[model samples]
Target: MSFFPAVGVGVIGVLIGGVCLMSQRKSLFGALLSMEVFTLSVYIMIFSVVWFSGSLTSACLLFLSFGVCEAALGLSVLVSLVRSTGSDYVGSLVSGHF
Candidate 1:
């Protein structure tokens, strides 16, 4: 496959990740979605490098596992936050009235 194209894709992925990072999410769900987008972008960049090198397939699998687990943990924490606080908005959390 074309290496440079993959590299370009990786760069685009990073830009997406940056955008996700800079955004101010409205709720825990929004935050989790943003985090996932960031994770996927990083994973895309890593996967591209691994795939192009034609080795370290095992590492790629591990990376995929890490991404899944990270998302799960984030969701669980979000659920807990919503259940205990009764609100999902970031503004609610910031006001210290939850």
Candidate 2:
């Protein structure tokens, strides 16, 4: 086991946890970006621990694909919400007649 990889994983874990906490006060777009940050941090941690083998390589690729897909889907939802609500903040999500 490498010392730097362990340190890097710890740093990324802290970043992921910080982003999760920060997302609560952010707008939809900001929250989605934070989520992407969190996912990328997880990917970094996984790569740090796992050697790239046949099955593991495929799994890593799939994991990366999902992260990208999630970002794109979140962005699309943000756009739709902005179009309907005229704002990106959480409190602007009210559904009744306004």
Candidate 3:
């Protein structure tokens, strides 16, 4: 597909991900998944721009690397939360005990 269409799709993906994140705040896993969606959409947008311009492909790779690191960090936090709180609910973090 063309760059503009790809960018439009990415924008839609970002909006959907944002809405999901806002509406599905009950679980940490769900939040992380939504954030991943957002990240992926952003990557798509950036990659399209770079691909069309034929430059800065390394910038896309750097963004992808950051996204991976973010995912790993979120997963580690989720695991720790589960271990300490025994649940993945977002409410667990608001109880002033974590």
Candidate 4:
């Protein structure tokens, strides 16, 4: 219903997407950070739309829970990768010989 929220969300979504897609992220940290940013942007857009509609509170809560879980999973994976490879380089996962 609001003009500004919609415009703001669209702009943020575009900027984040462009940055994530264009950047040559080489580390697992950079990749995870971008993923988190993407998740946050989605949450913000959904929350804003739901705020205007005054419904789908359940959906927002579910999305928040899922986002938290995803972040935790990503962090665990990053730690594991660092411990095993001694670095978080994205190429290490595929290029290193076992």
Which candidate's lDDT is highest?
3
Those runs of model 1 whose alpha carbons end farther than 4 Å from true positions after fitting are: 94-98
Off by over 4 Å in 3: 94-96
Q: For model 2, which pairs clash?
A: none
lDDT for 76 in candidate 3 is 98
Q: Name the candidate that leads on TM-score.
A: 3
Q: What's model 4's lDDT at 1? A: 65
Best-to-worst ranking by lDDT: 3, 4, 1, 2
Minimum summed lDDT over a 10-residue window in model 4 is located at: 89-98
For candidate 2, lDDT tens digit of each residue in 1-98? Answer: 56477648747775875667585684877777677767777777666555532235656678889999998899888888778888888787666723
**What is the TM-score of each predicted model, taking all chains together?**
0.80, 0.74, 0.91, 0.79
lDDT of 4 by residue, 1-98 (tens): 67577749856975786588458467878877877777777778777788777776789899989999998999999898898888988776765542
The per-model lDDT (C-alpha) reads: 0.76, 0.72, 0.92, 0.78
Cα lDDT of model 1 by residue, 1-98, tens digit: 78778777767867776777678567778767777777777777787888778786787778779989999998888787788778777666745544
lDDT of 3 by residue, 8-98 (tens): 9899999999999998868999999999999999999999899889787589999999999999999999999999889999786756677
Error of 4 at 10 (Å): 5.6
Q: What is the alpha-carbon lDDT for the whole of candidate 4?
A: 0.78
